[model samples]
Target chain A: MLSEFRNPISFARRSTANRRTVALIAGLVATLALAGCHKKVKAAPPPPPPAPSAPAPTASITATPDTITVGQSTVLSWHTTDATSASIEGLGPVPTSGTRTVSPTESTDFNLTATGDGGTANATAHVTVNTAPAAPMAESNLTEQQFEENVKPVFFDFDSYSIRPDAQSVVAQDASFLNQHPNVNVVIGGYCDDRGSIEYNLALGENRANAAKQALVNAGVSPNRLRTVSYGKEKQFCTEENESCWQQNRRAQFTMDQ
Target chain B: MMNGKKQPLYLLLLVCFLLLVITPALRAQDWVHTGTNLGVQHIRVAVASFKPLNNNAQTLPLKSIFDQTLFNDLKNAGIFDMVSPSMIPPEMPGSPSEIHLNLWSAAPANAAMVVFGNIAANNGQITVQGFLFDAKNPTTPQILGKQYSDLANDEATRMIAHRFADEIISRLGGGINGICETHIYFVSNRTGHKEIWVMDYDGQDAHQITHLGDVALSPRVSPDNTRIAFSALGRDGWAIRMYSLTLHRLVYFRAPVGNSFSPAWTSDGTKLAFSASGPSGNNEIYTIGANGGDLHRITAFRGPDVSPVWNPKTNSQIAWVSGRTGLPQIYIMNSDGSGIQRMTDGGYAVSPSWSPSGQFLAFAWNRHYGPGVLGGQDIYVMDIASKRWIEVTHGAGNNDFPSWSPDTRHIVFQRDNQIWTMLSDGTDQQQLTHIGQNIMPNWSWK
Candidate 1:
């Protein structure tokens, strides 16, 4: 109804102005469309990416025995392929590459990590916490008692003839046992590793025996009750040339005189 | 009466001419050899000839010194009627096997014993091979023996010949064993320190036993030849230590802090008598069980008393060198350290060692008899009962520490850090060692 009421002349003038405005609008739309198309093409080139190069994360993580016995300690450390771990669980970064001792806790697995490059490398350490093996118990008045009680109590350095300080107590104890039983006689038998000449080892064995006897006498044992003999390298508890067996052979033993 | 006096003068002149004619044969045959002959009256000995063993043709040092020694060893044996090699005619056969038995049979020699030996050089070892023969029967030569000995390259081969001479004496049954196998134990200071060394009687095959490089003195062997007791210093200090010849062990008995030395083992090998200085520095003679038991104080004295020598047979008396009279002297006491009697009279005498036969005591004496130069210490032997001391060695060298041989016929002592020996009397002195400067030779009973 409103369009029928409009004049022809007004309609024509309005139509020309509308045509010019429409052409101007069309040009602006074309320019805006071209800019949008240019943006789409530029974004397609950027889709290939600058690669995943953010620096490979170093594997500075390591594993260690989780639990150490009471008398022994185990080392726990971290390993990294490229970078090192700053610290683990606030224990502080291991300045040098090695095993670190954690608090003697229950046996458990621990996760260790190294934070660097693109990621963190982690390793699990199984610690077996155990109590130290008890030293052999000492007793008196048996045939083999002295072997276990006195000799077993004494520990010697590897391939050394000199008696250790810790072995003094054993000698003194044996000395006291002999002194207490005045009728009982004792002999300090010195032994050595098979490392020197027979004559030299015999002399060394004698020295070891003498040293034990001196210690016994110093502990108030009568020199008469205690005699010394050197077996040299003739006798050995263990003949193998390993640290474990050598430690067992180099010892001065106390035996009741027959 | 005038004719009878003229006849007596002519007879005396004729007797003198006969004595001059027979003197050459007597002088030519110096050694008076004794042999057990049931059928023969004269037993002849012929020393075989041989060529030098090696091309090294070097004369040993001290030739005259050792030649005299060889002469003493053989001459003293009294078994050989030694015919001088020069006395044999040049036309006579040289080697024992080459001997013309008929010529020797017609000569003064009957049943001649010939010694032929070869001296060969093998590396540093010398092999002396010899065979004894009856020169009267040259075809039947007896192979006496063969011995190989290690000797220094520079030593003379003459000792080898002397050794063969000794073997010849043994084969003749002079009743004395040859000294080739005998060894001499002495202390040597060649390493700038004293060590015990054992060498063959001829001063060859020398070897050091104690590498301690410390002062080792007064070495005495056991009667059984199984042990050697001497004094050595180690980390434990100066004490008497015994080395078992069989076990080769060094055992030190528990002694007081002060030097416990001068150990002399009993003949039974069960006990040892030694001079001990307590921590208080009171030197006393003490007897201890061989295994370090039952230590008994033998002497109670304030002066330094040492050098104990046990009587092998008596076992009741100990003849020791003591310093009781403000100077070192020889003293004898009971086994329990009672009834002490001074054996040596005046001057300074020490190291009294009783002979194995228990008849004589050997000791060393030094006197201030000269104007300013003090008398040099020399070895002396004294009769135990008579207490008459006879000086055995007399010279400028300081001879001390007389150690009697197991047979009691020879005494070895120390002179200038070397071992020397002489007869029981002061005669036939000879140096036994030329290297390492040996002292304190202890003869083994075995």
Candidate 2:
């Protein structure tokens, strides 16, 4: 035991002499430990908690009136409140739900509703009973799509007997609508842009108006439903500059034939 | 020294590990069309459509014409990963089925969307039905909103299809927006002389934009669609003039020493790119302010460089048809007229319309390739990036001067005396005008 104690004392003296070696080891070990700890901390930030589940939206329907006068629709609209998924059925087909389509029958109750979100609303439409409402006094108003389908037909291309496709739909749709509405007689007034000679545009405009009337007859509309007139490029919708105004002026208009 | 070695080694290893961890997050698929993870980088479009009926068997009816027009319109819109028609399945011989979501899915359209349609005619009337299938949502295929038009026996099926193409774009929440409605401004020889006329994008509701009856030609629509700049053969000579459609006003630019023709508008609507031949004695590219101030000549060349089309997005480069190469070919140079690179090698490529994406150009060239009117001119399009050229109009009639729609989906030009529109891919060439002669269709931008 006395010898061991003397040896340890000598070892302590040697360690003191080799203090740089110990310090170097200590520094290296400290760095390794710090790096390892840093990596662990970096990996510890956990992922966020999952979102709370939500219920699907519900669909519902509403009508202004349960019953409407004869020859009138009840104007019912379907609304979905909270249901996630909803579809309407039994209007035209199982797939025709949520779309606006006129009913074919005269006196049937429209059973329609949208279902989605978390809740549903229902609407019952009672179409009014009436003899084909004696063709109301002639009015010459038309919708945007109607302008494309009916009024575009009368204008002729330059020096050619050919008609372009974009304008044909306007003629076809107008003729079809005229056929459907017997009392509403219309005049197709053809106009031209400022591009051509006034007389040339007038003749072209007349050709266009005549073309629309011809299409109406072909589409099964009575001749009494339409007449023709020409206003070659005289009136302008966009009369300010270039093609923008020219396009608007080169059109056929529908007016009530009183 | 030994401890020092260990520390350096450890430091190096830690640095290597950090690099390894950071690399993957930096390189991920970030170029997505926003709102969806399934990004479509390429789209292929092919139509197997119904053929035309020949009431008069005397003339051979061309069946593929309408299909070509529709294809062209959709391709020009720049939304699809269009596939060529050759790659499409054989078209059904008769009526087509309502687009099935399953077929689109089975085809695995490179794009998550597909358009399929049918055209039928009887007794001088026509019907076209089309559908847009969202391959991403296979359960519901939207019946592309449509309008049924009645056409005469003489009307071409090709034009009807262009309208249908426009409808397809409108359904996608683009193209037919109010401002995008088609417009044409042209110098018409109708009133015993030439005058400027403007009309809807489809040639309806035409009105005079300029009452100046002096052979107005080469009308260009401003980027905002509110103004137009045109050159008229005035009493003095040719005059470059500006007119506002919204304000109904006209302003004349400083007439260069001689004449100015073929005016093009910069995207900002503040500048005009045109051709002016002055004391310089050569037709060179020049720029002037929208309000008629600050005239700057861009190209100082010996040859005639006319019809300058400025890209709407970058506005740094202008693509125009130049005779600098001895023969007319398409060329692109800095808006300042530097670093010019010739784009086309083919013969007589004129009237270059730079599409909104700036990746495709539509021009008219007379090809001696296949059948029909050998040496007659037709319009063609080239993909600037892929260098793929697709012929748009085929056969006898001359299809020239194509102006791309603002949405870049449709190109309107004149074939014969009437205006027509089609897709950028050389499909669906449809006529838009009927009475009187119309030409020089300039489409508006929203």
The CAPRI category of model 1 is incorrect
List model 1 lDDT by residue over A110-183, tens digit each. 55566655666666667677765432332234455544454343455532344577887777777656654665
TM-score, structure 2 vs. true: 0.42
Off by over 4 Å in 1: A1-258, B1-46, B50-113, B117-178, B246-257, B278-280, B369-373, B434-437
B404-436 in candidate 2: lDDT tens per residue? Answer: 876665788888768887666555566777767
Chain B TM-score list for all models: 0.69, 0.62
Model 1 agreement with the true structure over B1-446: per-residue lDDT tens digits: 56776998898889999899887765454223221231443345654344344564332232233334444455443345655655443342324445455554455444366544445555655555556666555465554655535473434445665566666665675345555445677777889887777775546667877677666665777767677777775533357777777876676556553456668888888888887553223457788887888888888753456778888878789987654444456899999988899987555677777887888888877643211234467777878898865666776577777776554556777776677776566555678787656666766543
Backbone clashes for every candidate come to: 20, 98
Quick one: best TM-score, which candidate? 1
Candidate 2 Cα misplacement greater than 4 A, ranges:
A1-258, B1-180, B255-257, B367-374
DockQ of 2: 0.00
Task: Put down candidate 2 lDDT per residue, A1-258, tens digits, no spaces.
Answer: 323323553474467548858878999999999999999998996454232544444444544554444445555466544433344445532221343534323555666554443345555555544545434432344444554454443444332222467766766766666766665667666666654422234344544555566666778888766656544454555666455555566665776665
